[model samples]
Target: MKKETQIGYRVSAICGAVALAFAGLHAMPAQAHGKNDVKHVLLISFDGLHEQDVARCIGSNACPNLALLAKSGVTYTNAHTPHLSDSFPGLAALLTGGSPKSAGLFYDVSYDRTLYAPLDSTCTGAQGWNVVFDETTGIDAKGGGPLINLDGGGAFNPDAIPYAKVGGVCTPVYPHNYIKTNTVFEVVKEHIRGSRTAWADKHAWGYDWVNGPSGKGVDDLARTEINSIDPKTGTYYLDTYTHTEVFDNIHVQALINEIDGLDSTGKTSAAVPTVFGTNFQTLSVAQKSPVADNGGYLDADFTPGPQVAAAITYLDGALGRVVSELKQRNLYSSTLIIVTAKHGQSPTDHTKLVKNGDTLTKLLEASNYLDSSGNFGQNNTTTGNLNDGSGLSGTGFVQTDDVGLIWLRDQSQKDAVVKTLKANLGCTAPGICADGPQAYILHGERLEHWFGDPANGRTPDIIVQPNPGVIYTSSKSKDEEHGGNAPDDSHLGLVVSFPGLHHGGRTDDRYVYTTQVAPTILSALDLDPDLLHSVQVEGTRTLPGLGIEHEHSQDRD
Candidate 1:
């Protein structure tokens, strides 16, 4: 048998032992309800959504279903994501009740200490630090020829991908196995009887990673491959007009099926999911489209272009379908609906858009911080191919979007590298750089203050924050991106609606983090929020202002 297969068996045995260790833990009573009330909790995420967009859509009557949800629950106007918000960290915060510090998740494509690149044979090769498990790495080359299976259920090949070494054992780090902490799904299943969880997401890879360590958190995982290449056309479907919008409907339909007690495969006799949800990418896609007014927002004013307006209408309609389904099944009053975003898009104002003249990679390459032969350009040919690790491990590896993160191999060169970066692109003042767009450089201990320390294995050594409208890429295909400290990226929409809340339709101005969602869900179900390992480490609290108390509160040792 192959080494990865043997390791998989060993890991499976370890997970089984861990599950058995906790199997005897008794289920807790429902805190906010009696034995017969509030049995289901549905959590939904709308990617790239901003709080202002939600207000604008509801105020202008562009989204009647969202307005109705707000009328029946509480809307948090000042809610925000972590300072350095990305989809991976954002979702981890929601499901783990912790920030990147506690959850050990920064982005889908990030650095790791003990993981080896699949293409590298030395195991300690320079490319080993570069572990990517996204769509490109997880594509299934069978049946339809690179077509993503929405219901594949961890069907991707593990041996072909990079593996992470834990306790001297190397195991294929599939999406469902990457997370370092337990998710709300595991908490629900371990603490509640007959509790099954389901989720649908954009990629089959990163989304499945939410199953947490034991690899059994989510019962049904629907992988809607948004960027799959069409076998017949030999082109990426997401590049086509309104293709993502059409594909999003499939996930919404899956939610309906799950609510109706059908499996993601459309088979009956499946148990209804206790906690089920999916994400909407229409708004994010619309916002980034180069076409003006293509069903996305125009500027910070949130004036919906035709496409953005239509996307909002479509998402609102999807929510309406979920509500109608629950009501029809007499499950509406028993469900908790959460409307929020994984991350907000940047450059909300098109007029302020600035193409970075001197990219960070060029500056780093010139400084000898990057491999001399490596193609550190916008294409990222070397890192993308997982080849030529040469300078990546010893020198440093830089990852960028709207923001930039640098992981250095030698701690002694930190001061020199930071000094060089400042000389090239550092801001003169808070947000004003000498050349190019305004930028802020954070290094040394400041990195730990904002995004934890590099010793944690996931935190970056240095962070680059540019002006709201500044982007590193020159690609004309997108107008805006996320992953920065700007208000446009950090601020997001958040709402919590339940049947027995004290106040409905009232807006709260409290400053709450998205990480609070995990603990709150546990509390609502009468399960201890501290059951989530990260929650205990971070002391994350349940979202306040819901006017409901958890039945029991205990800290996990």
Candidate 2:
């Protein structure tokens, strides 16, 4: 038998329900309910974390905390993020239980149909200007203008904006504007009753939107700012914090003060949430481990590897601290801590991939596809021309970290562009764009598998995938990146540990994709996993061993 299967069998037997505990590590399962039966679910996400890196942490003993958590939780051997693993969309999935296919969040800068749905020039209104949803934008473009005080201006400023200055607007959709589906957090509040929650994130776009409001509403749905100050040593250090949470050590004094205020009988007490979590940037520092951090990459230039490791380690430590505090507060065993990530980064060796040399860029450049509008592909005229002279139709191109979605003005011209891309990239028959075994093509519905929306205004006509090592970053930034189908980009780590989790430490090699994360999280929470209207037609299914049969997606190949 294969080594992996053997290991799986052994783990399955060891962690079987009602089975004898291995070395008395965990207690036998029993009924859990009510306030006493409640579980404080903590979903801690380490952004840009890679599955391989987590595995490496286990191998190298770099992340002992995570390793111990893994022992108590079920680890998915096959977990992946979307082809375009950006912070906004990734967090959207975790909170809403849907994919970009449904959410209409293809990228940070996405096209909206409602405001711009009817492409006729006569549809004039502020909504038309609110084409792309910005996380900072709290407006509902479909509703004509900003929704709440927070919409146009407030403590939480989520508003619709344009991708560029010239043509169509790229509105920024926040949790309120972005998510149309029911969220697990909402479900949790619905059934559980009397569960106070709190959350903190450094990323403007990152948050558990379903369970918490975007800004100012939840007891503590604000950002946290962290500084790696050695309070014990009275020394300054590098640390991360969100916008509203504990700042440098001195700022945290206020939090301490607030807690103290809760005790003074006559003193007014700031509301303290029963369930609260805040993110830090210490791990992000690790993922973007600079030369000062003693990892790869030179000064000013950062690699994703060390930074990812650091972020994981930082969160592990923070989680440990939180867990310890909870235990001290006598809420340890009852709390369900779910440590996860918004999404993982697509590991890129920019230095090598660029040097290997491919002609696709040059071909596109020669055809004036790169900068159609002379505004350097910013807006307006850029969206109208550039391909087969089919007027302004072929101007749609969504550039990602390692792929470019080219929408042709005319469907008939697609084959010609495909041929040109193939010839330039040197892709073989089966491959799409062949550039020294580096580039591949994804067309039609197959592309839809990776990207939820693949046709009409939702889909890109041609997806340009770079080689594994290649990362198609914009000219401005030269650091870490994501948004590709490469194994390094799509692959991520998934650890599920909760009251009803049937298995632990057992690896499931059955193929899994990023799209499944939504349904899986929903199922684990015992919520319905309906693929939202914003998502593609298909929905993710519960795994076989999880005590429920679920719909499994067919193999892409």
lDDT of each: 0.70, 0.45
Which digits, one per residue and each the tens of the lDDT, describe model 2 over residues 1-557? Answer: 11111011122333454345432643332222321322455566666666666676776777777776676566666776655566556666665556666555556554332332223233343222213333333322222332222113233322222222124544433444444454444444444345444455542232424443333334444432122233444432333222112232222232233223231121445443434344444443443333334432322223334544445455566556655555566655555555556665443343443322224444554555544332322244323422111122223444555556564434456667777676665433223344656467777677767555444355566778776655443232233455666665566776655443344555455556555555544333333445232323555554333333222221100
Compare the candidates by lDDT and give the number of the best one.
Answer: 1
Residue 476, candidate 1: alpha-carbon lDDT = 74
TM-score of 2: 0.66
Summarize candidate 1's per-residue lDDT along 1-557 as a digit string, tens digits.
Answer: 11110000012334445544654562111122342355788898998888998998889888888898887777889888867677888888899988877777777767765566554443555433655555544446322245444433346644235556656566666666667789999888777777889998877765777898888999888766776754545666466336676778778889888888898767765888888888888888877877553634565586777767777788889899988998998899888889998898887787867665437766666667766555432124333433222214333467778888777656567789788876665433222232444457777777787667786666777787876777777677887788777788888999887765433777877798898888878766656777899888887877755544323423211
lDDT of 1 at 472: 75
Q: Please give each candidate's TM-score.
A: 0.85, 0.66
Instruction: Show the colliding residue pairs in model 1.
Output: 31-551, 175-209, 294-307, 295-307, 295-308, 296-307, 296-308
Clashes of each: 7, 57
lDDT of 1: 0.70
